[model samples]
Target: MPTSASAFEIQSDFDAIDFAGGMIAEAKRRTGDNAAIEYACADMFDWLARFPEAYDCILTVGTLHHVDLTSALRAMSRALKPGGRLLVLDLVRRPGWRYVLINSIVWDAPASFVDGVNQIS
Candidate 1:
């Protein structure tokens, strides 16, 4: 775990999505003998499809709220090797007061939208 943390780092950037390495042009900067880091630009969904093993550790901050949580977590599970650790701290279904507070913000959405939110929760 500590081995990969400081030795090398990969950071991805995309206009459409925030992720690791993106295009030939940008990745070219980090490739060849001059390459200090490998740059890859690919979607997480597609990327995970290519790797069937688990990761040593997966870190997600508040980002998972953008996608359907179940699907995302399943994908993460698929990519994770056995005993892989996935650490995530994101939005949660708040019971009582917090739930009411969040509902208030989405009150303007159509009823079906509200239902969809509930389903996702």
Candidate 2:
């Protein structure tokens, strides 16, 4: 369930679906309320399935590094209609023993070893 669709699009155009809460809110606040401004506080995966063929270009940036990337992406792919475009930008890292060690050290950075405080806290 991999997807190329995104909420944070790189390009702004007529085909772009601005799937962002912060942007939507900022627009309303700055522009003094425009009626054409459409916004939703919804999950991306759930939203895609609801409107399969409504969009053409999709963009997702820097999300896979946070949560269950596989499950989220799979659902997004299914949501897309045929020929729809998707773009995914994430901090891709090699999965290995070395990766695990480096992440353990830097994820709780400024201290190489945190006296197991990283594990406990």
Candidate 3:
């Protein structure tokens, strides 16, 4: 990973933003590096639309499925600088009970946590 880069994390949910803040803090504490990271509680489309070609990279996790994929991708493309990267991690399939149970056991996660993974779609 590059030693220095600007990162913006956008999420409309306050809880998700809070969780990300905690994770960022933990990461900084462990790595002992102060990375430039900005957290914005805004709808992804609105934020991206405001920053045309402003971001070096755009990444979304478990979010695109909830919106119009084509529009979302276009917005991301506009937001990213030339040669910038876009990475998206989303649910490709709805998890069955068996898959959920196995994931819960393998990750040592609670039933609720596993269930929430199902909602990503």
Best by lDDT: 3
Judge candidate 3 at residue 110 and give its lDDT: 28
Candidate ranking (TM-score, best to worst): 3, 2, 1
Angstrom error of the Cα, residue 108, model 3: value is 29
lDDT of 2 by residue, 1-121 (tens): 5366774545533322335778657656776644444556566666767775565545555554554544554555554445555555555576854334334322321111222232431
Mind giving the per-residue lDDT tens digits that candidate 3 earns over 19-120? 345654664566564244454456777777787877655556666546665566667777766666665555545454533322332223222332344344
- After superposing all C-alphas onto the true structure, candidate 3 shows an RMSD in angstroms of 12.3
Name every residue pair that clashes in candidate 2. Answer: 1-73, 1-74, 4-86, 4-87, 6-59, 6-60
Using all chains and alpha carbons, the TM-scores for the candidates as numbered come to 0.45, 0.46, 0.50
Give residue 55's lDDT in candidate 3 (0 to 100).
62
Q: What are the candidates' C-alpha RMSDs? A: 11.2, 14.3, 12.3
